[model samples]
Target: MSGAPAGRAVAWLPVARPLTLVPAPPPEAAAAALGTVWPALRRALAGDAPLAVLPAGAGPADAARAVLRPDRPLEPGTDLVVVTSGSTGGGKGVLLSAAALRASAAATLGRLGGPGSWLLALPTSAVGGLQVLVRSALADREPAVLDRGEPLAAALARLPAGDRRYTALVPTQLRRYLADEPDALASFDGIVVGGAATDPALLARARAAGVRLHTSYGMSETAGGCVYDGVPLDGVGVRVAEGVELTGPVLAHGYRLDPAATGEAFADGWFRTRDAGSLAADGTLTVHGRLDDVVISGGVNVAPQAVEAALREHPSVADAVVTGRPDPEWGQRVVAGVVPAPGAVPELAELRPWVAARLGAAAAPRELHLLDSVPTLHTGKPDRRAVARLHGGDQ
Candidate 1:
């Protein structure tokens, strides 16, 4: 291979006929599928061609249909195609180069002390999981595939130990480990957790469980994570205006064939993330959710995450997700979906004041819904669209 072989998805670069790396359910099978698809992939790999990596269930059609990107033309030196489904269900493929992938993996390895094996806990179809495979490939190490169905401890025990061990996980995966025994959590030398916003409590608990948790912030466009534990990795840049703007080596080339969207997203080489965030005096970035997440309630803009965070502070509430439901009086009323802790029952009356005391009445949930568990995508991020449907609400 000309460039260092990328993760599980790009591993197929040498084999598959410029096909999308589809992510099937259960990360282990997706991780294992890479090897099984190798022969076909290996044959395809011979052409030294560039490939597009789309989400699973994209298509089996050849590159003409699969990669004939009219939205944003693939630039020279591009080798990876990643799809990012936006909040509106309108998605686009983010074009990344081999240089970008290596830069990201190198920055990660540098931050973590050195290269080593990785625990593949996310779907290979996604950039998060793909990066793990890429990093492993660059190090010439085999990654340990964690089956979501198995016990985390047992799965971890099976991974071959190496000089420097690391794993990538989303908040949902980290939450599971926070409950496991301490030793099981300590097995990884470094745990690079990203994919979606992470609750501070979850990170604290993970650390308490002996996990060297590093909260990361990035997306497919960044080739994975450009920030680790609130620090931008080497050669990466971060600044917040109305939202976060990320630049530097880790940044993606642009969207595949979508000039309008690409121009809107990448201006002056800085990719503008629609996430509302701020920089501290020390330059730590604190994300406040998406710009669209702000809801108008009674002629005032209220952040649902603020209400959600306040509700989740209740001992009876194990987890909380907040959204807006249409209301004639308020335009959009604040709504909360809560998961109760064991032996605890959360009530609207109890929750309202809990949030009111901390965040005032404007931040209190006008409607309450106690859930068994939050609805999540297969990749383990909150399925807010599904949650909205669960409450008969639309945003």
Candidate 2:
């Protein structure tokens, strides 16, 4: 076992075929160890597949024995598989290689001023969370994992005070931090917010509160976030084709066991993200929303993000999500789910005029629903489908 630190036990796990209960290590050390362990992992996974990665808190030895079995035919093209964020549909698995993983880690470190100790608030199973562990291992620092179930204040309190720390959060997390623990926001040198469209109001709030926040744009295929604050990071490249085409060091090799998806998403060494973005004259990129986020209302295309942005500018609106609900007259009509500022309830009719002045009458919501909280996925992104299902019709 590696004697680095109490949390750095991932390095010492035995190289057996069955599932391993290795402790999570720093990114750099973990990468180096993975170089050694991957060949064995591949070989073992080929036979009876005596390896299983026990979930957190499982007994290591027992977990190993339970999963070990005799040799079997290796599944062709099956390697490291990661699930994609199911924002649009059901989640799909993506395959990755050790080399691809390392290249992504290296590229990310190179771009983001090199890795330091990370404070992981996201789940490790998620691509964003997995990248944190990978980056920390590559940087030779043990990441401090925040309890997912803990309150934001309590979680922030657990992080050590003086180290240069990094953390990734979805926009909702940023909003919560800004609302609940303004002081804790300053603890990190940099904070990355992504996985959904961030409201202008939230960004303004964070900036006003003196939090260093960078809006990120990337997905699992790009090996986590390659773009930071609208600029492609070092070793990362961006292009606008049908949507946003991204390339460079952080790009993944391909999907696990699915050549067709690999071919469809990647073209000429670039990963084509279905997200729509435009580069401004000053060279900052502004992500509009997903290409599919556009809805036709009375034969006019209405971008929900455009409407949401306008609503967020209102002082009475604390948070807003704009989506389309089915309408017989207009195919799909614009609707807003809003969270009003504490003790201030703004009527839907009044909010519509406010949005119309900013985004034009076509962009105004036909109906508004006051919600205590908008439904969000585990990734902290708004669940548009759920919202649509809940209030798509009947107004």
Candidate 3:
């Protein structure tokens, strides 16, 4: 085991002396470094072993190896464990393997024209953020990390003009960047938006502003995103029977120390995503919403995604998330949390009829909450749990 300071904002060059207990090896310098660390990372996450991982704001010398007691035995194939954003339920650690992560990285690089220098706007702890780091390391280029809380324009200014600069962002970040600094959005060769549903209008606006935005679909089990701009990357397969189940080399081994979850997630070698989606005729995967996101109101299944898509058409609505709230009469009711466009305010009454006409009355939201900003997970997806918690009680 080795220790080193996490790289800084501009260039993420390694710092600190390498320790024998926890050897600090650069993933870029050694293609097999991830494989070398995979076993340790797996054991550490499984609670069967202890390893030192540098926490945020901690220096290299502060690294300490702490043992994690296993509640249960981790399955044999587990290699890496990643915790999901605990929105709907308590966060569960997802298990993956070095092979899966590497395969995903290879597929992504193949589809995205191989990697170059990446701009790290998101944190590395997240699957998406980790993908960025992995891609940069595989490409042997140090990513430029954006200063925390820095304006989008200021962050864009740091990168020198290049033919291949890439970055990943959530829909909210895309909306804010498009609204505040449209020109800045065009600086990157490619911009990936995912983690939550992205409003069509925002995508249109970004495209109009000359931003090459691509919507991604995947989760931690698949080693970040395996789909780009609706199309599954080479070697990634999408099937929608029962739910959106993905099959490919990128699928993870299983959940660490949770055989039940691992069995539930892996069926016939395909990862069964809780998300509901459809694969188009041309192989594009259009994700509708989560399987659990559907609201049963008066015995009718109300798709929140339908309502959210309809509301997003409104010029004033920059982003929208619709969820179900427990209701005594109808069992559940549709509610929406909306982020308005710059200098614009949303009127629920005016927007109701518009949504009703598009998605039908049953799918239209009964209550609309205008938010200054939509809550997002570290992965850049909408915090649906937060939205439900904030507005669900009222309904």
TM-score of each: 0.85, 0.77, 0.78
* Leading candidate by lDDT: 1
Task: State residue 381's C-alpha deviation in candidate 2, in Å.
Answer: 1.5
Candidate 2 is scored at a TM of 0.77
Clashing pairs in 3: 1-21, 1-22, 1-23, 2-22, 2-23
Which of the predicted structures, 1 or 3, would earn the higher TM-score when compared with the native? 1
Instruction: Give stretches of model 2 more than 4 Å off.
Output: 1-79, 148-157, 281-283, 392-395
* TM-score computed on alpha carbons, candidate 1: 0.85
Model 1, runs deviating above 4 Å: 1-31, 36-49, 52-75
Strongest candidate by TM-score: 1
Candidate 2 lDDT (Cα, whole model)? 0.66
- Candidates 1 and 2 compared by TM-score, better number: 1
**By summed lDDT, which 10 consecutive residues of candidate 2 come out lowest?**
65-74
Question: Which scores better on lDDT, 1 or 3?
Answer: 1
Instruction: Please provide, for model 1 over 1-395, each residue's C-alpha lDDT reduced to its tens digit, 9 standing for 90 to 100.
Output: 48655663444332233433433434445556456422222222233545544344434223324444534334655676666644445556777777788889888999988988777778765678778877876777777777757676776776775466788888766766666556777888998888778877677767877789888888888999898888899999999987999999988888766778888999998999888888889988888777887878888878777777676668898888888889998899888999998999888888888888987777788898889998865445677777888889986
